[model samples]
Target: MTTTHISPEFTALLQSCGLKHVAIIMDGNRRWAKQKLLPGLVGHKKGVDALRTLVRFGSDHGLQALTVFAFSTENWQRSTEEVGYLMRLFVEALSLELAELHRNNVQIRFIGELSGLPEDLRKLIQSAHTTTATNTGLNLQIATNYGGRQEITQAMQALGNDIAAGKLKPEDITEALIQSKLYTQDLPDLDLLIRTGGESRLSNYLLWQSAYAEFYVTETLWPDFSPAAFEKAVQSFAQRERRYGQ
Candidate 1:
Protein backbone atom coordinates (compact mmCIF):
# COMPACT_ATOMS: atom_id res chain seq x y z
CA MET A 1 0.00 0.00 0.00
CA THR A 2 1.17 3.51 -0.84
CA THR A 3 1.65 5.97 1.99
CA THR A 4 -0.45 9.10 1.93
CA HIS A 5 1.32 12.43 2.17
CA ILE A 6 0.43 15.17 4.63
CA SER A 7 2.08 18.58 4.80
CA PRO A 8 5.28 18.68 6.83
CA GLU A 9 3.87 21.56 8.87
CA PHE A 10 0.95 19.40 9.97
CA THR A 11 3.31 16.58 10.86
CA ALA A 12 5.37 19.02 12.90
CA LEU A 13 2.25 20.19 14.68
CA LEU A 14 1.39 16.59 15.62
CA GLN A 15 4.86 16.04 16.97
CA SER A 16 4.70 19.33 18.86
CA CYS A 17 1.47 18.15 20.48
CA GLY A 18 3.30 15.00 21.62
CA LEU A 19 1.07 12.67 19.66
CA LYS A 20 2.62 9.22 20.03
CA HIS A 21 -0.19 6.74 20.62
CA VAL A 22 -3.62 6.62 18.98
CA ALA A 23 -6.66 4.37 19.39
CA ILE A 24 -9.64 4.12 17.13
CA ILE A 25 -13.08 2.61 17.27
CA MET A 26 -13.57 1.61 13.67
CA ASP A 27 -17.35 1.77 13.62
CA GLY A 28 -19.96 1.93 10.84
CA ASN A 29 -18.72 -0.74 8.44
CA ARG A 30 -22.17 -2.27 8.36
CA ARG A 31 -23.82 1.09 8.17
CA TRP A 32 -21.54 2.09 5.31
CA ALA A 33 -22.54 -1.03 3.43
CA LYS A 34 -26.19 -0.47 4.19
CA GLN A 35 -26.04 3.01 2.78
CA LYS A 36 -24.66 1.63 -0.45
CA LEU A 37 -27.17 -1.23 -0.53
CA LEU A 38 -24.32 -3.73 -0.34
CA PRO A 39 -23.67 -6.70 1.83
CA GLY A 40 -22.37 -5.91 5.29
CA LEU A 41 -19.33 -8.01 4.52
CA VAL A 42 -18.44 -5.60 1.73
CA GLY A 43 -18.42 -2.76 4.22
CA HIS A 44 -16.09 -4.72 6.47
CA LYS A 45 -13.77 -5.40 3.54
CA LYS A 46 -13.64 -1.70 2.80
CA GLY A 47 -12.97 -1.04 6.44
CA VAL A 48 -9.97 -3.35 6.20
CA ASP A 49 -8.71 -1.30 3.27
CA ALA A 50 -9.06 1.82 5.38
CA LEU A 51 -7.13 0.06 8.11
CA ARG A 52 -4.29 -0.64 5.71
CA THR A 53 -4.16 3.04 4.94
CA LEU A 54 -4.20 3.85 8.65
CA VAL A 55 -1.26 1.58 9.34
CA ARG A 56 0.70 3.26 6.56
CA PHE A 57 -0.34 6.66 7.80
CA GLY A 58 0.85 5.92 11.30
CA SER A 59 4.14 4.48 10.13
CA ASP A 60 4.81 7.30 7.68
CA HIS A 61 3.88 9.97 10.23
CA GLY A 62 5.98 8.49 13.06
CA LEU A 63 3.23 7.35 15.40
CA GLN A 64 4.68 4.99 17.96
CA ALA A 65 1.56 2.93 18.50
CA LEU A 66 -1.85 2.50 16.85
CA THR A 67 -4.59 0.44 18.45
CA VAL A 68 -7.86 -0.27 16.69
CA PHE A 69 -11.05 -1.84 18.00
CA ALA A 70 -11.58 -4.44 15.32
CA PHE A 71 -13.91 -6.98 16.88
CA SER A 72 -15.39 -6.48 20.33
CA THR A 73 -16.55 -9.24 22.66
CA GLU A 74 -20.05 -7.84 22.41
CA ASN A 75 -19.95 -8.27 18.66
CA TRP A 76 -20.78 -11.93 19.17
CA GLN A 77 -24.33 -10.82 19.75
CA ARG A 78 -24.66 -10.21 16.07
CA SER A 79 -26.11 -12.84 13.77
CA THR A 80 -24.22 -16.10 13.58
CA GLU A 81 -23.70 -15.68 9.88
CA GLU A 82 -22.25 -12.22 10.25
CA VAL A 83 -19.92 -13.35 13.00
CA GLY A 84 -18.75 -16.25 10.91
CA TYR A 85 -18.11 -13.97 8.00
CA LEU A 86 -16.07 -11.64 10.17
CA MET A 87 -13.99 -14.53 11.41
CA ARG A 88 -13.29 -15.63 7.87
CA LEU A 89 -12.50 -12.07 6.92
CA PHE A 90 -9.93 -11.88 9.66
CA VAL A 91 -8.25 -15.00 8.37
CA GLU A 92 -8.25 -13.74 4.83
CA ALA A 93 -7.07 -10.26 5.61
CA LEU A 94 -4.26 -11.38 7.83
CA SER A 95 -3.07 -13.90 5.29
CA LEU A 96 -3.05 -11.29 2.57
CA GLU A 97 -1.77 -8.24 4.47
CA LEU A 98 0.64 -9.68 7.00
CA ALA A 99 3.60 -9.73 4.61
CA GLU A 100 3.21 -6.12 3.55
CA LEU A 101 2.69 -4.97 7.11
CA HIS A 102 5.79 -6.84 8.24
CA ARG A 103 7.78 -5.35 5.39
CA ASN A 104 6.65 -1.92 6.52
CA ASN A 105 8.06 -2.68 9.98
CA VAL A 106 4.69 -2.82 11.71
CA GLN A 107 4.52 -5.07 14.75
CA ILE A 108 1.10 -6.72 14.74
CA ARG A 109 -0.63 -8.03 17.82
CA PHE A 110 -4.12 -9.21 18.64
CA ILE A 111 -5.47 -8.51 22.09
CA GLY A 112 -8.52 -10.06 23.76
CA GLU A 113 -9.63 -13.61 24.56
CA LEU A 114 -7.70 -15.65 22.08
CA SER A 115 -8.89 -18.95 23.48
CA GLY A 116 -12.46 -18.30 22.37
CA LEU A 117 -11.70 -17.94 18.69
CA PRO A 118 -11.53 -20.81 16.26
CA GLU A 119 -8.31 -22.77 16.41
CA ASP A 120 -7.32 -21.85 12.90
CA LEU A 121 -7.88 -18.17 13.47
CA ARG A 122 -5.93 -18.37 16.71
CA LYS A 123 -2.99 -19.98 14.89
CA LEU A 124 -3.04 -17.32 12.21
CA ILE A 125 -3.13 -14.53 14.76
CA GLN A 126 -0.22 -16.07 16.58
CA SER A 127 1.73 -16.38 13.37
CA ALA A 128 1.11 -12.78 12.52
CA HIS A 129 2.31 -11.59 15.90
CA THR A 130 5.39 -13.75 15.80
CA THR A 131 6.19 -12.72 12.26
CA THR A 132 6.18 -9.03 13.12
CA ALA A 133 7.50 -9.27 16.65
CA THR A 134 10.83 -7.66 15.84
CA ASN A 135 9.47 -4.84 13.72
CA THR A 136 10.30 -1.38 15.08
CA GLY A 137 8.13 0.98 13.08
CA LEU A 138 4.58 0.97 14.40
CA ASN A 139 3.07 -1.05 17.20
CA LEU A 140 -0.27 -2.09 15.73
CA GLN A 141 -2.65 -3.60 18.25
CA ILE A 142 -5.87 -5.05 16.91
CA ALA A 143 -8.48 -5.60 19.58
CA THR A 144 -10.33 -8.77 18.69
CA ASN A 145 -13.07 -10.04 21.00
CA TYR A 146 -11.97 -7.47 23.52
CA GLY A 147 -13.82 -5.56 26.23
CA GLY A 148 -12.43 -3.01 28.67
CA ARG A 149 -14.34 -4.34 31.66
CA GLN A 150 -13.36 -7.90 30.91
CA GLU A 151 -9.71 -6.95 30.58
CA ILE A 152 -9.73 -5.29 33.99
CA THR A 153 -11.47 -8.24 35.59
CA GLN A 154 -8.96 -10.66 34.15
CA ALA A 155 -6.12 -8.50 35.34
CA MET A 156 -7.55 -8.49 38.82
CA GLN A 157 -7.89 -12.25 38.69
CA ALA A 158 -4.26 -12.61 37.67
CA LEU A 159 -3.20 -10.29 40.46
CA GLY A 160 -5.22 -12.33 42.93
CA ASN A 161 -3.48 -15.50 41.82
CA ASP A 162 -0.10 -13.88 42.27
CA ILE A 163 -1.04 -12.78 45.76
CA ALA A 164 -2.21 -16.28 46.60
CA ALA A 165 1.12 -17.62 45.42
CA GLY A 166 2.94 -15.14 47.70
CA LYS A 167 4.35 -13.34 44.68
CA LEU A 168 2.62 -10.10 45.60
CA LYS A 169 0.75 -8.61 48.51
CA PRO A 170 -2.57 -6.81 48.19
CA GLU A 171 -0.82 -3.63 49.32
CA ASP A 172 1.64 -3.97 46.43
CA ILE A 173 -1.12 -3.63 43.90
CA THR A 174 -1.20 -0.17 42.38
CA GLU A 175 -2.66 1.45 39.28
CA ALA A 176 0.68 0.92 37.64
CA LEU A 177 0.62 -2.76 38.54
CA ILE A 178 -2.82 -3.14 37.08
CA GLN A 179 -1.80 -1.30 33.95
CA SER A 180 1.19 -3.53 33.56
CA LYS A 181 -1.15 -6.48 33.38
CA LEU A 182 -3.15 -4.93 30.58
CA TYR A 183 -2.62 -5.78 26.90
CA THR A 184 -1.15 -2.32 26.34
CA GLN A 185 1.46 -2.47 29.09
CA ASP A 186 4.39 -2.00 26.73
CA LEU A 187 2.80 0.85 24.78
CA PRO A 188 2.25 4.42 25.80
CA ASP A 189 -1.08 5.60 27.14
CA LEU A 190 -3.55 6.63 24.49
CA ASP A 191 -2.82 10.14 23.25
CA LEU A 192 -5.88 10.31 21.03
CA LEU A 193 -8.99 8.18 20.53
CA ILE A 194 -10.96 8.62 17.33
CA ARG A 195 -14.37 7.09 16.77
CA THR A 196 -15.70 7.06 13.25
CA GLY A 197 -19.37 6.77 12.21
CA GLY A 198 -20.28 9.67 14.53
CA GLU A 199 -20.10 7.65 17.73
CA SER A 200 -19.50 9.57 20.96
CA ARG A 201 -18.98 6.69 23.38
CA LEU A 202 -16.00 4.58 24.22
CA SER A 203 -18.06 1.38 23.82
CA ASN A 204 -15.80 -0.72 26.02
CA TYR A 205 -12.56 0.10 24.27
CA LEU A 206 -9.30 0.86 26.09
CA LEU A 207 -11.16 2.30 29.06
CA TRP A 208 -8.15 2.51 31.35
CA GLN A 209 -5.69 3.68 28.71
CA SER A 210 -8.03 6.41 27.50
CA ALA A 211 -8.28 8.20 30.82
CA TYR A 212 -6.55 11.26 29.40
CA ALA A 213 -6.95 10.73 25.66
CA GLU A 214 -8.27 13.52 23.51
CA PHE A 215 -11.27 12.21 21.56
CA TYR A 216 -12.17 12.99 17.96
CA VAL A 217 -15.45 11.81 16.45
CA THR A 218 -16.51 12.16 12.85
CA GLU A 219 -19.63 11.31 10.93
CA THR A 220 -17.49 9.69 8.28
CA LEU A 221 -17.79 5.91 8.40
CA TRP A 222 -14.89 3.60 9.11
CA PRO A 223 -14.52 2.53 5.47
CA ASP A 224 -14.16 6.18 4.48
CA PHE A 225 -11.87 7.32 7.29
CA SER A 226 -9.05 8.74 5.22
CA PRO A 227 -5.63 9.97 6.20
CA ALA A 228 -6.86 13.55 5.75
CA ALA A 229 -9.60 12.84 8.26
CA PHE A 230 -6.99 11.49 10.66
CA GLU A 231 -4.92 14.64 10.17
CA LYS A 232 -7.96 16.72 11.03
CA ALA A 233 -8.27 14.71 14.20
CA VAL A 234 -4.69 15.47 15.10
CA GLN A 235 -5.31 19.13 14.37
CA SER A 236 -8.27 19.03 16.74
CA PHE A 237 -6.12 17.33 19.33
CA ALA A 238 -3.46 20.02 18.92
CA GLN A 239 -5.89 22.74 19.98
CA ARG A 240 -6.94 21.00 23.18
CA GLU A 241 -5.65 21.93 26.65
CA ARG A 242 -4.72 18.59 28.15
CA ARG A 243 -4.35 19.43 31.81
CA TYR A 244 -4.41 15.71 32.75
CA GLY A 245 -6.69 16.71 35.60
CA GLN A 246 -4.23 19.49 36.59
Candidate 2:
Protein backbone atom coordinates (compact mmCIF):
# COMPACT_ATOMS: atom_id res chain seq x y z
CA MET A 1 0.00 0.00 0.00
CA THR A 2 1.22 3.52 -0.81
CA THR A 3 1.89 5.84 2.12
CA THR A 4 -0.36 8.89 2.28
CA HIS A 5 1.16 12.18 3.36
CA ILE A 6 -0.16 14.05 6.38
CA SER A 7 -1.62 17.51 5.77
CA PRO A 8 0.28 20.62 6.79
CA GLU A 9 -2.43 21.44 9.33
CA PHE A 10 -2.06 18.03 10.92
CA THR A 11 1.71 18.50 11.01
CA ALA A 12 1.19 21.77 12.80
CA LEU A 13 -1.13 20.06 15.24
CA LEU A 14 1.45 17.39 15.98
CA GLN A 15 4.10 20.02 16.59
CA SER A 16 1.78 21.83 18.95
CA CYS A 17 1.18 18.58 20.80
CA GLY A 18 4.91 17.94 21.12
CA LEU A 19 4.70 14.57 19.40
CA LYS A 20 8.25 13.48 18.84
CA HIS A 21 9.22 9.96 19.88
CA VAL A 22 6.88 7.14 18.84
CA ALA A 23 7.09 3.44 19.68
CA ILE A 24 5.24 0.56 18.06
CA ILE A 25 4.55 -3.01 18.99
CA MET A 26 4.27 -4.46 15.52
CA ASP A 27 2.15 -7.55 16.11
CA GLY A 28 -0.16 -9.95 14.26
CA ASN A 29 2.04 -10.89 11.30
CA ARG A 30 1.33 -14.58 11.82
CA ARG A 31 -2.37 -13.93 12.32
CA TRP A 32 -2.48 -11.91 9.12
CA ALA A 33 -0.86 -14.71 7.14
CA LYS A 34 -3.22 -17.25 8.68
CA GLN A 35 -6.20 -15.14 7.71
CA LYS A 36 -4.90 -14.96 4.13
CA LEU A 37 -4.29 -18.74 4.06
CA LEU A 38 -0.59 -18.12 3.35
CA PRO A 39 2.57 -19.21 5.10
CA GLY A 40 3.47 -17.20 8.18
CA LEU A 41 6.69 -16.10 6.58
CA VAL A 42 4.73 -14.23 3.92
CA GLY A 43 3.12 -12.13 6.64
CA HIS A 44 6.50 -11.28 8.12
CA LYS A 45 7.75 -10.18 4.70
CA LYS A 46 4.74 -7.89 4.35
CA GLY A 47 5.32 -6.56 7.83
CA VAL A 48 8.82 -5.56 6.74
CA ASP A 49 7.27 -3.58 3.92
CA ALA A 50 4.99 -1.81 6.41
CA LEU A 51 8.02 -1.04 8.56
CA ARG A 52 9.84 0.48 5.60
CA THR A 53 6.87 2.74 4.97
CA LEU A 54 6.66 3.73 8.65
CA VAL A 55 10.32 4.70 8.72
CA ARG A 56 9.87 6.88 5.66
CA PHE A 57 6.76 8.45 7.15
CA GLY A 58 8.56 9.27 10.39
CA SER A 59 11.46 10.85 8.51
CA ASP A 60 9.23 12.85 6.20
CA HIS A 61 7.14 14.05 9.10
CA GLY A 62 10.22 15.12 11.10
CA LEU A 63 9.73 12.72 14.01
CA GLN A 64 12.65 12.67 16.44
CA ALA A 65 12.71 8.92 17.00
CA LEU A 66 10.74 5.82 16.01
CA THR A 67 11.26 2.69 18.04
CA VAL A 68 9.78 -0.56 16.72
CA PHE A 69 9.43 -3.85 18.50
CA ALA A 70 10.76 -6.03 15.70
CA PHE A 71 11.51 -9.21 17.62
CA SER A 72 10.90 -9.94 21.28
CA THR A 73 12.88 -12.24 23.51
CA GLU A 74 9.84 -14.50 23.88
CA ASN A 75 9.73 -15.04 20.13
CA TRP A 76 12.51 -17.57 20.54
CA GLN A 77 9.84 -20.04 21.64
CA ARG A 78 8.33 -20.19 18.17
CA SER A 79 8.90 -23.26 15.97
CA THR A 80 12.47 -23.74 14.90
CA GLU A 81 11.60 -23.46 11.22
CA GLU A 82 9.73 -20.20 11.71
CA VAL A 83 12.46 -18.71 13.86
CA GLY A 84 15.10 -19.67 11.30
CA TYR A 85 13.06 -18.09 8.53
CA LEU A 86 12.74 -14.86 10.53
CA MET A 87 16.50 -14.70 11.07
CA ARG A 88 17.09 -15.14 7.38
CA LEU A 89 14.48 -12.53 6.57
CA PHE A 90 16.18 -10.01 8.89
CA VAL A 91 19.47 -10.56 7.11
CA GLU A 92 17.85 -10.17 3.69
CA ALA A 93 15.86 -7.08 4.66
CA LEU A 94 18.80 -5.29 6.27
CA SER A 95 21.06 -6.03 3.32
CA LEU A 96 18.49 -4.76 0.85
CA GLU A 97 17.28 -1.70 2.76
CA LEU A 98 20.27 -0.42 4.72
CA ALA A 99 21.75 1.53 1.83
CA GLU A 100 18.50 3.36 1.06
CA LEU A 101 17.88 4.12 4.72
CA HIS A 102 21.40 5.47 5.14
CA ARG A 103 21.00 7.61 2.04
CA ASN A 104 17.88 9.10 3.63
CA ASN A 105 19.93 10.00 6.72
CA VAL A 106 18.09 7.65 9.08
CA GLN A 107 20.21 6.67 12.05
CA ILE A 108 19.66 2.92 12.59
CA ARG A 109 20.09 1.41 16.01
CA PHE A 110 19.32 -2.04 17.44
CA ILE A 111 18.51 -2.35 21.15
CA GLY A 112 18.57 -5.73 22.83
CA GLU A 113 20.83 -8.59 23.79
CA LEU A 114 22.52 -8.33 20.43
CA SER A 115 25.24 -10.68 21.55
CA GLY A 116 22.71 -13.50 21.29
CA LEU A 117 22.15 -12.97 17.56
CA PRO A 118 23.96 -14.93 14.87
CA GLU A 119 27.42 -13.65 14.03
CA ASP A 120 26.53 -12.70 10.45
CA LEU A 121 23.39 -10.86 11.52
CA ARG A 122 25.30 -9.09 14.32
CA LYS A 123 27.93 -7.96 11.81
CA LEU A 124 25.25 -6.60 9.49
CA ILE A 125 23.54 -4.77 12.37
CA GLN A 126 26.86 -3.26 13.34
CA SER A 127 27.40 -2.19 9.77
CA ALA A 128 24.00 -0.52 9.67
CA HIS A 129 24.79 1.36 12.88
CA THR A 130 28.17 2.55 11.65
CA THR A 131 26.82 3.55 8.25
CA THR A 132 24.04 5.68 9.71
CA ALA A 133 25.73 6.89 12.90
CA THR A 134 26.19 10.45 11.64
CA ASN A 135 22.80 10.74 9.99
CA THR A 136 20.55 13.46 11.42
CA GLY A 137 17.09 12.71 10.10
CA LEU A 138 15.18 9.97 11.84
CA ASN A 139 16.39 7.86 14.74
CA LEU A 140 15.17 4.34 13.94
CA GLN A 141 15.47 1.96 16.86
CA ILE A 142 14.69 -1.72 16.24
CA ALA A 143 14.21 -3.84 19.33
CA THR A 144 15.25 -7.38 18.48
CA ASN A 145 15.33 -10.02 21.20
CA TYR A 146 14.39 -7.26 23.60
CA GLY A 147 12.23 -7.17 26.71
CA GLY A 148 11.65 -4.20 28.98
CA ARG A 149 12.07 -6.22 32.14
CA GLN A 150 15.28 -7.68 30.83
CA GLU A 151 16.60 -4.26 29.95
CA ILE A 152 15.87 -2.92 33.44
CA THR A 153 17.45 -5.96 35.03
CA GLN A 154 20.60 -5.54 33.01
CA ALA A 155 20.81 -1.87 33.90
CA MET A 156 20.44 -2.64 37.59
CA GLN A 157 23.13 -5.26 37.31
CA ALA A 158 25.45 -2.75 35.72
CA LEU A 159 24.78 -0.28 38.46
CA GLY A 160 25.48 -2.93 41.06
CA ASN A 161 28.79 -3.74 39.46
CA ASP A 162 29.72 -0.10 39.36
CA ILE A 163 28.96 0.32 43.02
CA ALA A 164 30.90 -2.81 43.90
CA ALA A 165 33.92 -1.54 41.96
CA GLY A 166 33.90 1.78 43.88
CA LYS A 167 32.98 3.70 40.73
CA LEU A 168 29.59 4.68 42.11
CA LYS A 169 28.07 5.11 45.54
CA PRO A 170 24.70 3.66 46.45
CA GLU A 171 23.49 7.18 47.17
CA ASP A 172 24.54 8.33 43.73
CA ILE A 173 22.05 6.05 42.00
CA THR A 174 19.10 8.03 40.72
CA GLU A 175 16.48 7.87 38.00
CA ALA A 176 18.77 9.79 35.71
CA LEU A 177 21.60 7.36 36.33
CA ILE A 178 19.34 4.40 35.59
CA GLN A 179 18.08 6.09 32.50
CA SER A 180 21.59 6.53 31.30
CA LYS A 181 22.13 2.76 31.53
CA LEU A 182 19.16 1.87 29.35
CA TYR A 183 19.57 0.96 25.68
CA THR A 184 17.55 4.05 24.82
CA GLN A 185 19.67 6.30 26.99
CA ASP A 186 20.28 9.13 24.55
CA LEU A 187 16.83 8.97 22.97
CA PRO A 188 13.74 10.79 24.11
CA ASP A 189 11.14 8.96 26.21
CA LEU A 190 8.27 7.59 24.16
CA ASP A 191 5.56 10.15 23.52
CA LEU A 192 3.22 7.71 21.86
CA LEU A 193 3.10 3.92 22.09
CA ILE A 194 1.06 2.24 19.36
CA ARG A 195 0.12 -1.40 19.25
CA THR A 196 -1.33 -2.78 16.05
CA GLY A 197 -3.27 -6.07 15.66
CA GLY A 198 -5.75 -5.40 18.48
CA GLU A 199 -3.47 -6.33 21.33
CA SER A 200 -4.12 -4.25 24.44
CA ARG A 201 -1.11 -5.37 26.43
CA LEU A 202 2.43 -4.11 26.07
CA SER A 203 3.84 -7.68 25.93
CA ASN A 204 7.05 -6.46 27.54
CA TYR A 205 7.86 -3.58 25.24
CA LEU A 206 9.42 -0.26 26.34
CA LEU A 207 8.03 -0.56 29.86
CA TRP A 208 10.07 2.09 31.61
CA GLN A 209 10.14 4.61 28.81
CA SER A 210 6.38 4.38 28.32
CA ALA A 211 5.50 5.44 31.84
CA TYR A 212 3.31 8.30 30.64
CA ALA A 213 3.06 7.58 26.92
CA GLU A 214 -0.26 7.93 25.14
CA PHE A 215 -1.31 4.56 23.73
CA TYR A 216 -3.14 4.00 20.45
CA VAL A 217 -4.38 0.49 19.81
CA THR A 218 -5.77 -0.64 16.46
CA GLU A 219 -7.22 -3.78 14.97
CA THR A 220 -5.14 -3.30 11.82
CA LEU A 221 -2.48 -5.92 11.51
CA TRP A 222 1.15 -4.94 11.16
CA PRO A 223 1.25 -5.88 7.48
CA ASP A 224 -1.81 -3.73 6.78
CA PHE A 225 -1.19 -0.71 9.03
CA SER A 226 -0.84 2.17 6.59
CA PRO A 227 0.62 5.60 7.13
CA ALA A 228 -2.85 7.13 6.97
CA ALA A 229 -3.82 4.97 9.95
CA PHE A 230 -0.73 6.17 11.79
CA GLU A 231 -1.70 9.75 11.03
CA LYS A 232 -5.05 9.10 12.65
CA ALA A 233 -3.35 7.73 15.73
CA VAL A 234 -1.13 10.77 16.05
CA GLN A 235 -4.14 13.01 15.52
CA SER A 236 -5.88 11.26 18.37
CA PHE A 237 -2.83 11.88 20.51
CA ALA A 238 -2.83 15.54 19.60
CA GLN A 239 -6.36 15.83 20.89
CA ARG A 240 -5.48 14.56 24.32
CA GLU A 241 -4.13 16.51 27.32
CA ARG A 242 -1.12 14.89 28.92
CA ARG A 243 -0.93 15.88 32.58
CA TYR A 244 1.94 13.48 33.39
CA GLY A 245 0.78 13.05 37.00
CA GLN A 246 -1.60 15.91 37.47
Q: Tens digit of lDDT per residue, candidate 1, span 157-241? A: 9999999999999999999999999999999889999999997999999999989888899999999998888988998999999
TM-score of each: 0.97, 0.96
In order, candidate lDDTs are 0.92, 0.92
Worst 10 residues of 1 by lDDT: 1-10
What clash count goes with each model?
Answer: 0, 0
lDDT of 2: 0.92
Between which residue pairs do clashes occur in model 1? none
- State the displacement of the C-alpha of residue 89, model 1, in Å, after optimal TM-score superposition: 0.6
